[model samples]
Target chain A: DQQVKQNSPSLSVQEGRISILNCDYTNSMFDYFLWYKKYPAEGPTFLISISSIKDKNEDGRFTVFLNKSAKHLSLHIVPSQPGDSAVYFCAAVITGGGNKLTFGTGTQLKVEL
Target chain B: DAGITQSPRHKVTETGTPVTLRCHQTENHRYMYWYRQDPGHGLRLIHYSYGVKDTDKGEVSDGYSVSRSKTEDFLLTLESATSSQTSVYFCAIRSGTGNSPLHFGNGTRLTVT
Candidate 1:
């Protein structure tokens, strides 16, 4: 059983527009959520994260909103650029689970010029 | 960018052959992880280590084994290669502090023929 799920396989947006990627989880024990960006042939890089206590966290053009009640989270990128095109993964971890992460399938984001 | 390096970036081997991938870290972090990324499967942990000679299995550890004789190195070995094991492998490191995000090495692409 997949604890985390990224329902959308891909998303496309125009440059300067907003791109939103969504994820869901079934495990209530997950207390931390993170987003990672991956380029072709490269490992994933940490992007932004939101704790269970916070509903939203923003950094630069990236913002992550967590809805604990719905067991869902979303990543928004405003003014999306070409460089933002890549596969984005959502990961969740239980607070005391030794930082072991459970990952979603992933969503491929493409920002067009 | 956490000073993690995965050796043998690409490898192709015949079935039943044994293969080992190496992950080296210069950050001196106490946590190291091995993950495999495949199409439609995002990233799944194979194994992880918390300290020297301390290792644990992750969600997908059935066909793999890991060793951590030192804090700076973690090794993942496949006793016998199989076509089902062909995938890209990544190594990640994190501080011992809980809730810390992970930093990853480039990756190693392994193909079993």
Candidate 2:
């Protein structure tokens, strides 16, 4: 069984629009959540993260919202650009686990011009 | 930018052959990890090292082993390559303090024929 799940395999949005990727987790022990963006032929790059104590965290154009009760989190990109098109993965880990993350299957986001 | 490097960006070998992948970091981070990225499975940890000579297995550690003799280098070895083992491998590093996020390398694509 997967501890983390990204139900949508792919998402597409037009330039200057908003893109939101969703993730769900079954493990209640997870207290820290993160999002990573990956490009073709490259490894994932850290994006934004939110702790269970906070419901929202923002970093420039990227924002992550966490709903602990629902065991869910979402990553939102405002005014998505072509450069924002990439596979987005959501990860989670329990506190004091030493950052051993459990990642989602990932959602491929395409930002059209 | 995270001072992480992965060697053998691409490799193709026959089944039953032994293979080793290397990850090096200049950040002097205390934590190192080896992860495999597959289409449906997302990124799963195979092994990790908290310090020199200290290592542990992750969620998916079968058929794989890791070693860290120095703070800057971590290695992952597959005892015998199998067709099912074909996937992209990534190396990541994190600082020892706080809940630091991971920084990943470019990745190594391995194909077992």
Candidate 3:
């Protein structure tokens, strides 16, 4: 069973448009959620994160909204650019659990010119 | 960046051969983790170390062993390679906080034929 799930395998968008990726989790023990971006041949890079304490967090064009009651979260990047093309992963972890994180399968987002 | 480094950017070995991937951190962070990335699998944890000689298993620890003899290095050894083990391995360092993000290395691509 997948503790974290990114239902959509990929998302395609045009420049200056918006890209939204979704994630769902089944574990109530998870209190922290994170997003990471990856390029081919490279490891994942930290993106934005939101805690269960809050419903939303934003960093520049990236905003993450978490709905605790629904056990779901979504990442939105406004005015997407070509450089934003990459695989995005949603991960979760339990509080004070030695930082062991479980990740989703990932969603490849392609930003077209 | 948490000053993480993974050795042997790429490796190919035959089945049954022993292979090890090394992760070194200059930050001496207390939390070190090993994760594998593959198609349909974003990043699956294999094992992790909280400190020297203090290690714990992650979700996918089967067939893999990790040793942290020192604060700066974590070694993951595959006792016997298998085709199923072929994937990109990443080393990560966490900030030790309850909800901090993880920093990762470039990753090591390993292929077991």
State the lDDT at B92 in candidate 1: 97
Off by over 4 Å in 3: none
Encode model 1's per-residue lDDT on B1-113: one tens digit a residue: 67998999999999999999999999999899999998888899999998999899999999899999989999999999999999999999999786889999999999999
Interface RMSD of each: 0.8, 0.7, 0.7
List, residue by residue over A1-113, the lDDT tens digit for candidate 1: 99999999999999999999999999999999999999997899999999999999999999999999999999999989999999999999986645989999999999999
lDDT (Cα, tens digit) per residue for candidate 3, span A19-111: 999999999989889999999988899999888999999999999999999999999999899999999999998878687889999999999
Q: Which candidate gets the maximum DockQ versus the true structure?
A: 3
lDDT of each: 0.94, 0.94, 0.93
Q: Candidate 3, DockQ to 2 decimals?
A: 0.89
RMSD of each: 0.7, 0.8, 0.9
Rank candidates, TM-score, best first. 1, 2, 3
Worst 10 residues of 2 chain A by lDDT: A92-101
lDDT of 3 by residue, B10-37 (tens): 9999999999999999986889999999
Model 2 chain B: ten consecutive residues of lowest lDDT? B94-103
